[model samples]
Target: MTENATGGEVTFADMRLRPELLDVLSALGYEEPTPIQKEAIPPLTEGRDLLGQAATGTGKTAAFALPVLERLTPQGDGAGPVALVLVPTRELAIQVSEAFHRYGRILGARVLPMYGGAPFGRQLQAIKRGVDVVVATPGRALDHIGRGTLDLEGLRTVVLDEADEMLDMGFADDIEAILAATPATRQTVLFSATLPPRIDGIARRHLSDPVRIEMGHTAGEGRETTPLVEQSAYLVARAHKPAALGRLLDIEAPTAAIIFCRTRDEVDQLTETMNGRGHRAEALHGGMEQEQRDRVMSRLRAGTADLLIATDVAARGLDIEQLTHVVNYNVPSAPESYVHRIGRVGRAGREGVALTLVEPREHRMLKAIERVTRQRIPVERLPTVADLQARRMELTRAALEECLLQDDLESFHAVVESLTDEFDLMEVALAAVKLAHESSGATPDEEEIPEVAPRAVDKRRGPRESAHDGERYQRGPGGGMTRLFFSVGRSAGIRPQDLVGAIAGESSLSGRDIGAIEIADRFSLVEVPQAAADEVIAALRQATIKGRRPTVRRERDTRGRRPR
Candidate 1:
């Protein structure tokens, strides 16, 4: 580290990063190292174990990724990846893998992200072909190791990104098993948002003499709110979300935006619906092939598409320079995921907006997110019809001004003169504007987007409603879901996937739409859209589960709430 001419604050150029990485950094417009990067990079490059405490968007990925890439072996045939980064989710695995690929691109680094739901054959092929670094979720990495398809004998570094989250997702055993497989001398690194006991236990077990680095707002400073984005949410019922989102977009008029949905089904449906509403929208999800994902990204980057409707997993690690807005179609299940979603916007010191569409039922999740982030997410009313029309007129006025300033009007003056001879000049101008407004594809019907009535929060427990609170679990969001009780449970060797597959095979509903599955020794509760509840119940009765018919009934009935 070198001293700044004025003080001792060193820049990234002063750090001992490889020249190629520096070049990439410069090309990417990274002027200085973030605090975590400043402290963690040096030790990491020196081949030391690192335990870093940093939140998402604090540049933790690069803290570990770049050092691992720098330690890669010179290009040559190798048994397997030299570096392994275990992440909590498929989205993160893909994101970290891409980061390593980008930083190491100049050095011809080969990186692969291993995760579930993706085709096993494709992952296997990539593993067999050889790679320099493997960024994976613990479960998939272990699966490959068990099949003897992934070789870790050549490993030199092992890093755990979001260590706490990995533990939260119940991958502690998988992480331990994977760690045990790696060489004893391998350098280990662990990064987490908070160092809970479990994370500390893992660090003690694996990370030897690790350098620790923590990054975030200082304690006692106290947060007014997360200061990056102008965060707001709308209480729009599920049925009116599409219309509400359209109206919100009209008000926002963002250069580019990402509309986050919970599932591929929603992403596909929303993308299709948004396009129908005259927006240039695209769909991205794990269900699509890599080629399709690349195509969608190409369009987004080329400015042909302005809106990306994607699931959290598919949109992970995506950095769009023109991204001016991030919309949550539904409140995220976890607050950390919410942080990651909005982190995509309000970056690089630019003012950006984040809007979430919350149903009355999900008001609790909104509160939960606010509590976790130590800030209040201001809830806003849905835009009225008059508001939408005013915004449309404002946009029309701006467009006309731009045209007048830049476009040559000499060709149209004669036409204007002839029209002036027949009509008033103001009337001619109004006619031209009317034609422009009509041709601009703005919503013709300025109907108000319906708003969801605000759900009153219970003073003691917040906005969450439980079983006694109207059996709300039976009444899922959109008021179209029912929880069905099943007689067969663990004693009968029933699994969640088994219940999922059985219902999906017997009915029109896919497993993705299934929610809130609970399995017990003698019974199980499965939630499906109310419209399909009877159909699912009927189909399950006729179709044998585990080769036998199991009693299935709607939990809507009190007796059905108990095991048959």
Candidate 2:
């Protein structure tokens, strides 16, 4: 590790990182460490307790996971977990566990994920058999401890991930109990987005002479002070949002952009809508299988999918260097979330753009975001049909200019000369230009997209809050049936089969318990027996359907009737 002139730490290439882990990072195109990683990794590898203050998507997981892998003992048959990671949500648990698995694969590390709605018996068996690392949610881990199914005697490191979110969710007691159960001498690492009083208290009580690392954005001389993201918004009527978004895409023509929706059904619907508009769009949510999610990401990285419609949770730790834009299909509810969403772009000093589609009512939230970032987000008018045509024509002209400059036109010159005898030279040139424009689909027509009234902002709705809420599902009169609503639909590249398969496989529920599924443009509604609603929701909560998380809740009927 090297210290910079500004007293900030830097990770040098010569610093030790496991060869296998480095190989994986190289394969993933991660060359340098993030600021947090540079400061946190050295101390963590030295077995010192660490309290890190950094927000999500800062590459903190790797900062800790690398140390954990470096310090853990080799696996033996049924040797019990050596490193334990506690997270707030099951999705996070799975994500952390996968990270450990990916980094430790060459070391033959056995990583197991234990969370609610998963088979407790299977998890218990895995614990009994032994694992190098255990990633679990606090509630479920505590349950395992109480049942004497998990052993922490051999633990070498304990990581409290997203500590602030856990505290916010009222898991302080559970966390304390789990910490007390672990060995007193074990190294403890706590990572939180904010160092609130509660987190400070935990650090004082749990960590011994720990190193504190904080990272902040700094303005440098001759270096750009602005964030890499060129932030902007488009004002449009609620009903014309889809059209507006499509038109904007047509104009900007980003190589790749992630369109963020608040709910899984919204991701699905938006993906479908974009696809219908002749864009190669894909949807990613939590309700999908790990394998399917991998495929979607593969396609995105391979440039097969230009637009990815996703939810915040489902897109965590997603690093796409080719990404040139981020579209907030809905304004984020919180400033922190907005920061994370836009942070995906504007990385490594690359120029990027963040485009938010703000409805009339969301203007206030947009203002709040600007205030928090201390940056002015320029508001722009929605793209008009004429504007789109102009942009497309410009693109067509640019492509033709490039062809004329670089292409070997000798072969085409003979063909052009033959046609010149019968056709006027200007006429032939116009015809060629017209053919090029048409082939590129750069010609725009004047068909207006149908508008839908903007629905009232659902105060109770959001990806994180609704993740664990039980009220999103409704039970039938007989108490035997339940229906859940997803904010994703056909437009988000979601199918009924994707929802059914995800719930049935990831949860303790069966296919017979799942009933009808209705997919729309911005959302989808699925019915399951009331007996299995909770289990299905918990199961799908962590699962990624269509490479995003299905904001699963009890469905409210068209008449506004909710299941009992």
Candidate 3:
């Protein structure tokens, strides 16, 4: 799970599952249970409450899903749902629901995925008809419960999948409400990638003497071990990021990759740019409808698209088997976020790569991520045009070698003989290789990316790092700082911590990146890095501040006037 291969090759059959389930596992080509599953299934099947911490692709779903199905009982015609799974987003809800369906189909289990954007009538009808399991997002699940259409009193088991993500999305209250409605004696299982204090509080309050399991990356004692992922970063100016990313992808030749951006606007723009550069890229964000998102996912899984350009929230809970690379368009604002994004690749013991594009000014935040993750992310130079050319030539050579191995050359022998008759044999072979390279679609590289070095941070000045040095209310992009205006202030119960948390949660900025804060009667002003100003504004626009849609933008110069 943590780029390390799962523990000893323990087969699913060794777990004593139902013969039918074992048969299905074999049919599906599943060889063994992952580390989480190996440790979790026995206790879960015994009906013990569990609190599991695992990364994204750790097979946690099966660890819980199989037990839920194994314990499933035959319900009466109008019985309430027996099991409930709460995920963070509609995409995850659908994905988890599909997994339950696939694994439980032979058992005649009824599963429903309830989320917003779908017709309420459909979900209502399905619930009334009765189901064995219901996979739902917290908000929509609470909505049904409030409407008196969903009954949780009969639930024998309740699962909080991706509990940390749900809490981050402000579903803590809804989760508490939903759990309160469930049977008090029911088995509770909480799975989170990271267990913060808040998650611990939930587990203590809800679970009854739960069994705890920690999987994925864990720092050792006073020593640094290499992560399973090949982590690296490139410090480049913002303008050259797109080109640099394209160059890196060409050199890596990833089987499939996901490029994470800060906002939907960024996802869209980069998706278009990557596609124009001839990469089969797809964009996924909260802005798209469920159907559109499903189509994009289908294409990627079917190998029609090799690159997925997505926002963080939209790509949650996705497990793509062929994914070999994860790219951070910008360094993550939160250190935990860096762990989550790269966890998508290098899973289940496969070698994978994690790439990041860091701007010169954001170097300090990158260091913060490294400190938190306890892994060194080497800042490597961008691949030059010459490097790209050499990679392309290598690819051409490999392709020709494969063709020679797999293709019959009898037909080409006649053409080769004809060409060699009029020219030297060596010259004819050179001409053929040139034609093969050209026909292989190796585009000529014309530009070299400018090199950039991270700005030196003066540790004596503390982490603020000249964040308040120049024009406190500068409107446009530059080096020092830019003032951002917010609509909510003291009246909305806004505080400086609230401002910092909002920006840090939504954008690729940490607490260290924010400078001074000025809260007025009707609005607030915060200084953020000029380099990340646009990204922060874009991310915040898509988010709510202090439970209100605050108008966020650059601070207008008002040197001589009193604040409104």
Candidate 4:
């Protein structure tokens, strides 16, 4: 197995793939095959059943997709797919389908993705018309087959991507059932990050004389020793995470990134928080519809959305072109999950960064991942205000230089000439630069996010004692919900949904975490679960109610009601 220099140069020609695929690869600027691509493509192209162990971002999609495209002869007026790629999640099914479409444009391969959330009618129609490839989640694929909407009789290749995850999600029966329907002579391939006995059992049962390829194939560099994922972890308190994440993003300044959160609520909340901080971020989770998911992906691919905050399941199989960073909002529950999250970056000779926020209590989880991966995730401190200032200055300087290069001075000469008569040229230039800097979106007035205890606290505590409004009653007599008072109310045209959306977006809390809402003409009272009151307040500090900043604080009671 050959590894190009760490992110080195090579060509699809070296792999001796089909000439049509080579042309498409060249057009896509795929100058070299990734480790998995280089290794797996050869045997796969020869129509061999194979088992591959590779993580995401290892170019596994291309590894399998390219060979499938190559072996496919022109369809002879057939309505059934020649190849099938089965993934564990709907997001993955769509991503894999897109990859096939991308790589096989020259071959005129008709690729379709079928999954549960989407309208069944569309998938049914596509299959009826005809398709070259079908990428589907196991359950949805089985559902179609049962309804006689999808036919697998003519399948030439069947790929089980993330085979272990499918089994873990309880799709083993569906997979077995699907395979049973496909011809026994069909080529069977399986790719996974790790091989449990379950995966081994599937390979043994399904594959015939399969070729095995492992992913950590490194060439001349010592990259195998360090690994290219640039893994790191941060020890952060739960309360400070929102502010801390903002500060770190300012320093890192990723081209595009995926921030992994554990739950749909966290994904939505972080998505909102990032947007509030002047970031273009999209949220993806199970709660979102197929249409919403499509729009989020479209925005991300169009480069209009830079940050994608998603839960693990929602992010499965995504392969974005300019993604440079992967941030885990919290350490994942399992080492395999950590592996999967970071696998989204460090693809195809790209230098990628993987950052994880580790609560003190979750430090063990991080270390466990380290033990499994056999690489230490360095703990990084949050960037300071001075550091952010330096980054901003660098950005401002870069922006100014770029504009100077691209903009013609002929038109702007009049303004500079007019200002030069009153002020020195140097002073005038500095003033113009100040205006550009002001519009650059860097907040020089950003205060530092306070540090919390070195170790994580078991129970939520106020980050600081409330210094404004009524006395805080966070932990009520019954220890359930605490009422918060916002200075803006019905007069400001704020509704419960607005408050709920804002709270869910800005803070770590979800809509369900909030209890009751009482709105008056000039003021409002809302009950939030006791534990998250401080976090909600922290998130709101950087937010606006009715496009204006308002006082949001813990209320002593909801008794006071007054009209505007």
Between candidates 2 and 3, name the one with more favorable TM-score. Answer: 2
lDDT by residue for model 2 over 214-239, one digit each (tens)? 64433222132247678998766667
lDDT of 4 at 194: 68
lDDT of 1 at 325: 94
Choose 3 or 4, whichever is better by lDDT: 3
Q: Between the candidate structures 2 and 3, which one is better when assessed by lDDT?
A: 3
* Maximum-lDDT candidate: 3
Give stretches of model 1 more than 4 Å off: 1-9, 220-387, 393-514, 522-564
Instruction: Quantify all predictions' global Cα lDDT against the true fold.
Output: 0.75, 0.74, 0.77, 0.74
Q: Per-residue lDDT tens digits of candidate 4, residues 377-445?
A: 888767889999888889889988988899777898998899899999999989887888889887888
- Model 1, 360-408: lDDT tens per residue? 6466557656656787899998889888878888889999999999979
Between candidates 1 and 4, the TM-score winner:
1
The numbered model that scores best in TM-score is: 1
10 residues in a row with least lDDT, candidate 2: 453-462
Off by over 4 Å in 2: 1-12, 76-78, 217-223, 226-230, 233-249, 253-373, 376-438, 442-563
Ranking by lDDT: 3, 1, 4, 2
**How much is the lDDT of residue 177 in candidate 3?**
86
| Candidate 3 lDDT by residue in tens digits, 100-177 | 988888888899998655567898888877888999877667768877999887788999997876665456766888
Instruction: Tell me how many clashing residue pairs each candidate has.
Output: 1, 38, 0, 0
